[model samples]
Target: MHMDIEKLVESGSIVNELDYERAMVADRKLRLLAKTNTHFKHLRNKLRNLIVEYEKRVWSNEDAVDAELLAQSDRAQLIIEKERMFLEKRKKIIQARLKDFSLTQAELGLLLGHKSKTHMSELINGIKPFTLQDLVIISKIFKLDIDSLVPKYLSIEKIDRISAVIEEINNPKLSKIKPTLLSAS
Candidate 1:
């Protein structure tokens, strides 16, 4: 999702991990820009304060998550975190390759159809989604394995959908594996 970064700043809310991450990126960008632009200093401080408040709230709510919800939350969070980790790995590898090859962000941006360096940076930082075609290009150019570049974890919704399909098909082999595959879901 292309988060409205300034809107996020003005609203002063960080509900989830993605929101927190985007806000952090925005805060960092503002900090860097604040060196040249005096206007960004106030914005950076505001976001930094928000992040601190968010951390405090999270610490205070530790007891809210009980044992009953732990399994489900763990499953969901692991899937989500795994996806993020995969993207982070991709970003690092891509960055390393760019530096090693003496490639400019502009050149990569043009190839990926993101003319704006800012948008490219967002994509590189996993703040935005990349199209499948873009991933394909990255894979080909960077020699990164396709499997390592994408999410392998099935979301709960996807697990449920596949379970339903397996039930509908009723193939003996699939039937035998369905319960095992979807047990976590």
Candidate 2:
């Protein structure tokens, strides 16, 4: 995704490709991950059951344990770990972009109606998650949707999660409820 964006920026500021089409690769990759992860989980559960039952049957036979099974379990565990690492890397990329356009911590605090830069930095650094209001404010300030601003290689699942969070924040019921609470208090 970064490569595409870099190419676009280098060529000119316009994205000649449609976003949905551009997102297709990410979507496919995410779908593959979903399928593989699901299979890995299912296999892991089966492996655990096998190990437990094997232990019951061959408690004294150390050599009876299947090394191949253990190897497969390790591979599955490694895959899951790699997926998690990839997600973290994607998050970092999004964070860096946020910082690139962000005001200083003090400036962000003022914009977000906070009294402390420490809290604001936490949000920007992903040490603390942003509230919906903060996400909205950041999106507007950057002229970007959280999804679009995020790294292109990021899984569509993560993008959808971010979009869902933003949508929930903008929901009319929550928006209305907040004002009512302020009025009542």
Provide backbone clash counts, one per model: 0, 0
Per-residue lDDT value at 163 in model 2 = 53
Note the Cα lDDT for every prediction shown: 0.67, 0.44
Task: Give the clash total for candidate 2.
Answer: 0
Residue 54 C-alpha lDDT in model 2: 38
Cα lDDT of model 1 by residue, 1-185, tens digit = 22555566688866654556556666765676667655567667777888888767653577865674455545545555555566677778888988987887778999888898766765675645677788889788888887656655555556668889988998989888765653322
Worst 10 residues of 2 by lDDT: 1-10
Candidate 2's displacement at residue 103, Å, is 2.7
**CA lDDT for candidate 2:** 0.44
Off by over 4 Å in 2: 1-102, 148-185
Tens-digit lDDT track of model 2 for 1-185: 22231122234322212322222223333343346456324433443344344345544476765776455444334333433344466456445655886646667667778777645543443323456686567567766566542322333334346556656789766555432321111
Give residue 144's lDDT in candidate 2 (0 to 100). 59
